[model samples]
Target: MAAKQAERQLVEIFGHAPRDHSSAARTFWQLNACPFIGKECTKFDHTRTICYGTCSVTNAEQEVVICPNRLYENNYEAIRKVGSDVFGDIPFMLFNEYVRIVASGNHQMDCLVALGHNSGKEVKISQLSMDWVIAHIRNQQLVEYVGIEVQSIDITGNYRDAWYAARDMRDSIPASGHGLNWANVHKRLIPQIIRKSLVYSKSLLVKNGLHFIVPEPVYQRFEAIIGANIPLVDRPGKEVIVVHTYDIGPRVEQGRMRRLVLNRELMFDLNEFSKRFISGPNLPPGIALDDKIRSILAVS
Candidate 1:
């Protein structure tokens, strides 16, 4: 017999599912809190009042991360992983905290400090912004830094009904035409990565290259869009861009979030990634477009 395919619906709300009835789950839902970032959920409804605390969702029986905050699980261990890989095994602190200590002349050098979206002032380069600017402090001076862009696939259609039903302790999640926005992976995300790579590649301070951190499935989709055979380095190197993919591991129990396991780290220079993007498999054929244009003209 064929196994039942999972319906596209809400799988996790504020890190756990609708079916979770534990006191901890209830408390998180009541408080509209996010365990990952250790604060109230950043996503909200249209009015910007109520928290829209959807974390992950079901797609083809697989739980996929939808919220970017969900990526901050395990105390931002993924960021730490990138720091260690690029700047060697060093301790990490929030960038703002580092600044405060530096002002007092008590800051330690040779440590990794991260300037994230919510961590005080943003560092912008020619109007482009990075999700996180990880810097290595040496001798109380800015030595080296890397730009990181973090993304979890966005969703199409509304899951508000399902979220409400889940929040109320419903037995079953309501169906709400929810689906993953896979198109955005190649359309917006990859292009943005390429553009940022170009900007960062020209800088002397950005020694480690720009990193794009995304969920495992999103990276798979990216490879499929652009031919998987494209040449890329397996280890971190002087490449202009690095792609880090992560998979969410199974939870030991309910009422707790899953662990994010680093799956793959692929590196590529600016020329390589941009070449793949321009001539990727997703691009339309020139002859086919010319024919469609002629047909439209003939109809007129």
Candidate 2:
């Protein structure tokens, strides 16, 4: 089949598993428990560190696949109206850059939005999602990752019910008393998704000796949490991979949106993990200077 041939070609090019082989090849997974209103997202930390939601399976593609919540995240309106088939209408080039980021295995937070499909391609939001997905695919070879723990109580085979566990995890979160930054908290979902991973992501958390910790300014709006990374132990393939969990939020901000987390220690305290993502005041991968931003804008 064409797909098989394409897979072989890609494997030859990158010496990696085919994109469809995530279940068998994935070593790194960045999963997110997002909000239902479509605005906010709660990133479970325990799942990131211990690989709590990790599972077992082979890399063989299944007969019936449930497309992740990604379809829902990209253009909720179009999907709500026309459904998955609508993607067929989107030009392949439109999804090309997105495919690049995912295959590369990392998310550049301060990325610029490029030109529309009409003009020459630029780094658009849609492209960003595709990029992270590709990254998940690329990181599948890391074998260092093992086990996943996020707030989830169910172990049902059906993906439809995964959110039930995720929701329970959300409920376990200690109450907070602060407003949230609309952009910082809400818009951060892409990176969260790009970084978090679990074998079985719950609407809440699933216990596996590891505690599923959540960051602050949290909210949940997603219906079914979709996993981006591939599963290794559950699969019968040999590959090397590792998941990098990052809490890139500022250590602290003085504003009404600041979350008044009742139990500060348990939550993903930003100050504690500040150094993990930021390297010695140097601008990390995706960030650019204000002048650069102005230049990009001018070019746009």
User: Which candidate achieves the best TM-score against the true structure?
Assistant: 1
- Candidate 2 residue-wise lDDT, 99-155, digit = tens: 476578654322221222211332234333111211111122311211211111112
- Tell me each candidate's RMSD, in Å, in order: 2.8, 25.9
**C-alpha lDDT values of all predictions:** 0.79, 0.24
Off by over 4 Å in 2: 1-99, 102-140, 146-209, 214-255, 260-300
Candidate 1 structure quality by residue, lDDT tens digits, 1-300: 999777677767777767788887888888889988889997787899888788887788677788888888878878777888887878788866787778988755678889886665567767677788888887878888888889999888888788778777777767757889998987898888888777777778877788888888878788887778777765554456788888778765666666878888777776877887888766789988998999989953
Show how many residue pairs clash in every candidate, following the order shown: 0, 62
Q: Least lDDT summed over 10 consecutive residues: which range in candidate 1?
A: 232-241
Number of backbone clashes in candidate 1 = 0
